[model samples]
Target chain A: MPSSPSNQSYHHGSLRAALLSHAMELLDTKGIEGVSIRAVARLAGVAHSAPANHFPNKRSLMSALAARIFNQLENEVLAQMETTSGQRAERVMAFAEAVVAFALTYPHRYRLLWRRESLIDHDAELHSAMEAVYALLIGTIEGEDDEFTTSLETRAIAIWSMVHGYLIMRLDGNLMEKTDELTQAPRHRAIITALLEGIGGGPSGARRDC
Target chain B: MPSSPSNQSYHHGSLRAALLSHAMELLDTKGIEGVSIRAVARLAGVAHSAPANHFPNKRSLMSALAARIFNQLENEVLAQMETTSGQRAERVMAFAEAVVAFALTYPHRYRLLWRRESLIDHDAELHSAMEAVYALLIGTIEGEDDEFTTSLETRAIAIWSMVHGYLIMRLDGNLMEKTDELTQAPRHRAIITALLEGIGGGPSGARRDC
Candidate 1:
């Protein structure tokens, strides 16, 4: 076999993305504990020193990985929220769907993002990046005051906690095993509806229901 | 120092407690990854084979640890809930306090129990034991409702998810940073109040001042 390329052979422009891509792949196969800068460099077909140029340490690499994950999440949820204007029920459902969909497809990433708070002190920029994601959700629920109740902060926290909580429970399989009758979609819809109705008023006061 | 009696020569009850107590101490100091049967036995002044009789493998030992942790949590929460009679706000506040207290004081055990879902299929008894702890919370919440607006199944999933999510967020140090001004006490009260009022339309609605 031919000898592998040395540290000098690595291209600079794409090394960061390549490292993150390989790191996520390792996380998929071996969980978070398996991810390391050296391990990622090995998988990315680069020399060990190549990864060092992009990430000084594993923590820095992880912060970037987490930021990208949140960036993707923000885009997905923002897109879903765009589809449901003026309809409170639809808005809540879309927001909840965005959360559950992300959790189901990328359970590891979901867990990692939730754990970001533990690292806020370790990295200041990450706190703002994550806050941006939270702000997007809060904005979606902070729609203009109707003739009825109006408190954006309360509504935002209420909706966020409810949806976030449900996603965690479902991903952990707690909700799945505890309730046999309802699958994820229908249960999600019911929860979304109940929370909106409970917030704005019962069915009659809700902005949209179907 | 006096010569310590070896676990092999120790009485059965004392050895079992010794193993568990030593393991718990390790858990507090070093986290789950640091605690193992061998380490626990060593810390307990036992021979290598001493713990095998009490816990065949790591999984069983973890299960026993989780069960004992939840048993303590259940008793503490139930006692607090009992002290608060018919006042919904007081009852809810006590419940939230009990949860935060457990998580803050026993951060390791709280993480162990919440993260235990990852190991559900490892043992049947462990799974059922977790459900029973959840059932205690559901039963208490159901007791508060004069008439059910949401099904018991829905309520259980929703309530457990809210508290679990909150505890996870707090223990991971996420919510703590956000609520430094209010302290976790008021922030959790706000979340719990939103859940209660968000479920039913009444004077119980969360105060707009928040």
Candidate 2:
């Protein structure tokens, strides 16, 4: 119960940092089911009960870990947005690329973030981080000057779902990575344009300046 | 190793069929991990070696079960497509509705279909069923007459990814079910339309008749 002071390697905020670092390693190597408070503590070379102050149970530990991962994702998207030329379509492309890069780089972490069942009460910090990313993405679409039949939320959801599904498919080996030959663009760029320009002139294909 | 002749409850093709039925029960109630050769054998009240004639291991058992489930999903989609009005967009809507219904009704079964890692060599029957369903969806898009910057395959992938993403999010309870207030269409319908018409006229928003 009072092992914090006795531990020389872990003291103050350092212990929490050590625990989280070890927790991420476990998550990356063994997936979410392999992670536990005791396992993380053991990995960190601390007493099993030492993590109690930071994470009381496995669920809380997972919740905190997920929140931390989402924060990284949020920062990635924000950094991409900040560096973009700020055009609506350009920002959309940048946003999609940032998310795809994140998912590809840390596939397991990306998977853990969406698996709400494995975390605790849908942790508030995690929720906010996710919402912030969504808000950032939607902000780009909201800047469009023309009127459309669908709401901004619909447009946002459509893009998000498409990217999310496409990302998961590639990560799971259900789909392959490809590129557009004529335009010399990644398949994702083609896909995003396909949605932006409509397909085969079905209801919204006219490029008129209306 | 199986005493099939002596067991009064099992005779002829019934043992194989019985094993499959119990395997599905395990899949529905306990997910993919719950169903295995040993577990199905035990559940069917047969010797552990009883399933050896039909399935050599957990992978083969899951492969057969996945094939059967894909057959069911294929039939559901075919029936929906057949009943559609033969219009391109109408058939597209019908195809999307059928898949959404199937995923909703058998969420666990739907989940297993895409999870190739749990099955054996991506069983031939299962592969054919999936290809057939995909061809059916792509057929609708191939009927479009106007010139499109994106190839037919790109267009197909875009809609497919959007619908797939939407379905998974709803199933996982990550996204709430909502309807389009202006057109009184389900959010899925709106999403489909959003992709169809493009958004805010970034490149394809004009509804002009060309």
lDDT of 1 by residue, B10-41 (tens): 45446776777888899889887788888998
Provide candidate 2's TM-score on chain A. 0.81
Model 2 alpha-carbon miss at residue A9, Å: 7.8
Q: How many residue pairs clash in each candidate?
A: 0, 0
Interface RMSD of each: 5.7, 6.6
Among all windows of 10 consecutive residues in model 1 chain B, the one with the lowest summed lDDT is: B1-10
Q: Please state the error at residue B157 of candidate 1 in Å.
A: 1.6
lDDT (10s digit) by residue, model 2, range B141-167: 785574666767777778778888887
In candidate 1 the C-alpha lDDT for residue A36 amounts to 74
List each candidate's DockQ score. Answer: 0.30, 0.40
RMSD (Å) of each candidate, 1 decimal: 5.0, 5.2
Candidate 1 regions exceeding 4 Å error are A1-13, A34-38, A46-53, A116-120, A146-151, A199-210, B1-16, B36-38, B46-57, B87-93, B117-122, B143-149, B199-209
Model 2 bad stretches (over 4 Å): A1-16, A30-41, A46-59, A177-185, A200-210, B1-6, B9-16, B30-39, B47-60, B116-125, B177-185, B200-210
Reference-based lDDT, residue B187, model 2: 73
